[model samples]
Every structure is written in structure tokens, then in C-alpha cells.
Target: MGTADAPVILVTGASRGIGKAICELLATQGAQLVMAARDGEALQVLATELSAHGAPEPMVAVIDLADADAVAGLFKQVFNRFGRLDGLVNNAGVLHEGLLGMIRAEDIDRVLAINVKAPLMAMQYAARLMSRTQRGSIVNLVSIMGVNGAAGLSLYAASKAALVGATRSAAKELAAKGIRVNAVSPGFIDTDMTRAMPEAAHARRVASIGMGRAGTPREVAELVAFLLGGQSTYVTGQVIGIDGQMVV
Candidate 1:
């Protein structure tokens, strides 16, 4: 068991990219983590690594975010094991790009199920746990595309946009109960998702950014760490852009 002061944080999408980065940074800070992802192997690897480095061995949950029941059970397990949850990072999401008219109903359903509904459901359960303690923080991983329209990513943008609105509304409703909710909108981060873009299209996107480069997952993770920690006690119901001035 972890010390009382050690925060118990649940992070979805913990297998790779930004999610992995967030887990790494928080481990260094001595947070007890519940890492969730569909990739059980990767999650186990991460859990072992964090343990080897002196952090508590993180609890790894293999879960498909599309299953609403599994999402709810994840929280139930967290509360049952840890006794309380101090933070939640809703980082699991899917990105599907296609012309508006060409997008299929199934694709839209898949994207929204993971990107929008899963996080919303996870927050619902996390809030229930936090309400009992009357304190905790929730950070939803939104996107810059959600704030600014992108031609080929209408479905993804719409889902993220909905999350942004939910973040604000949840913040208001939970603030009085000592829970804070916010979002991090990363712009053109160098993740596998962005790496798959055609070279020319990728260059054009990077060049358009004021920084002239794509942000690293660690950079985005740092912002998440700050928000989850005490440094941002006054911050809540805000959508912070980590796009290197790309969306300002």
C-alpha cells in the first residue's frame, strides 16, 4: 500500500505516446497509478519499468474503452483497491480522418464511442468517487482540432469539441465539491497518429505552427503533470492548448 500522501491517479490509454509520457512523469512524482489500455502487454511492460525505477508497481487494467460497463468497472476496481482517487486523466481517444460526406456511420460511431463517450463515462464514475472525498482533478485530453476546424477531421473534431463543452460544464458542477475538471488540447504532437500523415501534409502542418516544429509528448505530459499536481490549484474548467502557439 502507498502512503496516505501518495496520490492515486488513473490514466487511460497508458500503452504509448502521450499516455505513456504522462504515466512516466507522474511515477517520478510518487503517484500511485492505475494504468488502463487495450494493450495488456505494453501496460505490463510499463508497470514493470516504473517498479524497477523505484515507483510503486502500477496496477494495469486491460480494457476496451468502447465497453461502457468495463469503463465503469475500472473505477469500481480503483476505488476498491486504492480507497480513493485523487486524479483521473481521460487520455484514451481515436482519430479518424476523412471527407465529411465520405465518412461511414460505423466509423463515426467508433470514433465518438472512444473519444467522447468513454471519457464522459469515466468522468461520471470518477466524480462519484471524488464527491465522497470532496476533492480530486480530472483532465480530459482534447485536441486543437476540436477548438479550430480541420477539413478532413470533422468527426474527430466534433467529438473533441463535445468533450471540451463537457469539461467546462463538469468543472462548474464539481467545483463546489472540491473537484476540478480541465482539458489539454495538443496541436500536432509528434505521436504515431501524427507520424502517419503524408510527408507533404505533415510539413505543411508543421510550417503553419508558430514554433515551426511539432511538440513532443513529454512537453504535453509536463503540462498534464502540473495540472494534476498542486501547482494549478486555482485552475479549472479551462482548455489549455499545448500547440506551441499554433492555435493562439
Candidate 2:
């Protein structure tokens, strides 16, 4: 176990993929983790695995971020358990892929709820929870879609773009309180999120990557780990892209 005084960081969507990788890496570094996801079984398994690896057993919150009430309850539970939060990784999001004209209004609304509103609600809680801390960090996992609008992802793109703006604004607003906020805009990663695409669509995405390959979840996890650690004390309010040269 790390020093009993080690800071606790919360990671959303910790059931698999990038969120899974982030929890694993941080756990190995001995950070106390509060892992939240919609999958209770997955969160329990991951928490157990981390505990077996010498990391503190993660506290699990199986709550849907799409619900505002649930978001509030999550923060309350966190504060009740940990007393304070040192970091929050807003990694939970959804993408309803389709051309704007083809996507349903409900699909668009759901995407906005998850990809945009959820993060905003989490940020609000983090801001309040971290207000008194001597220092804290918040990392939002954005995407290249936030910067370069994708052809068939109008709703997704708009949501992430809004997240980027929120990250920037949050950083500036909270800096004086010793809070740092930033984002990581990943290109094409070989996560379930991307793997669900059709073969042809996947190929097109691969071809667009300047590095000629998709990134691994572990790669993105490392960047997030760095941002959460004390090593990044001076870095905040910037969106670091880990696209393997895709978004130049």
C-alpha cells in the first residue's frame, strides 16, 4: 500500500478500455482509487484485481452518469467515504455514430446527456469538493472529434468540443483555488468504442492516422496517469492530443 496519506483519485467508466487502463496504471502506482461505472460486476472484479496487486482496494460506485440525481449521489458517496477527492477523470462518454440527418433526435439528446452534460455535472461536483484542498487535478478525456469535426459525428463532435471549452474554462476559474483542469484528445484508439465500427469504416479510420496504427488503451492511460500525478503540477488547462500524429 502507498503512504496512508496518498491522495485518492476517482475515475469514471472504469469497467473497461481506456478507463480500465487508467485504473490499472494508477493502482500500480499505489494511488487510492474510487472507480465508478455502470457495470457493478466489472467494477467489483477490477477492484479485486487491483487489491491483489498491492493497490488499495478501490471504492466502487455503480451509477449512471446520464442521471443528474445519480451524479449528485456519487459525489455525496465519495465525500462520505474519502472525506475529500484529489483528482477526477471524466472518462465516461457515449457516441451515437451517424450523419446528422440520419441520427434520431433522441439519439442526439442522449449523446449530449452523456458526452456533455455528464461531464459538466461531474466538474461541478469536483469544483465544490476540491475547493478547499491545497491542490487537486481534473482530467477530461476528450477526442480529436472535439477539434476536427468528423464527417458522420456531428452530435459527438459537438459534445466533445463543448467539453474542451469547459475544460479550458474550468482550468482558469479554479486555478487560484489550487485546482488544475485539462483534457486529453485521443485520436483512434482500438477500444470497444472503435472496434464496434464496420470493417470498412475501421479501415478508413486507420488510414487517417498519421502513424498508420491505432493507439492502445494503455498509451492513453499513461498520459492520464501523468496528469493526475504530482509530476504535472505545472500543466493545466491544455488539451494534449495522443493521436499518434493523426490530428496534427
TM-score of each: 0.98, 0.97
RMSD of each: 1.2, 1.0
Candidate 1 similarity to native, TM-score = 0.98
TM-score, candidate number 2:
0.97
- In candidate 2, stretches whose alpha carbon ends up further than 4 angstroms from where it belongs are 1-3
lDDT of 1 by residue, 168-215 (tens): 999999999999999999999998889989999899999999988999
Best by lDDT: 1
Candidate 2 all-Cα RMSD: 1.0
Task: Give lDDT for model 1.
Answer: 0.93
Worst 10 residues of 2 by lDDT: 1-10
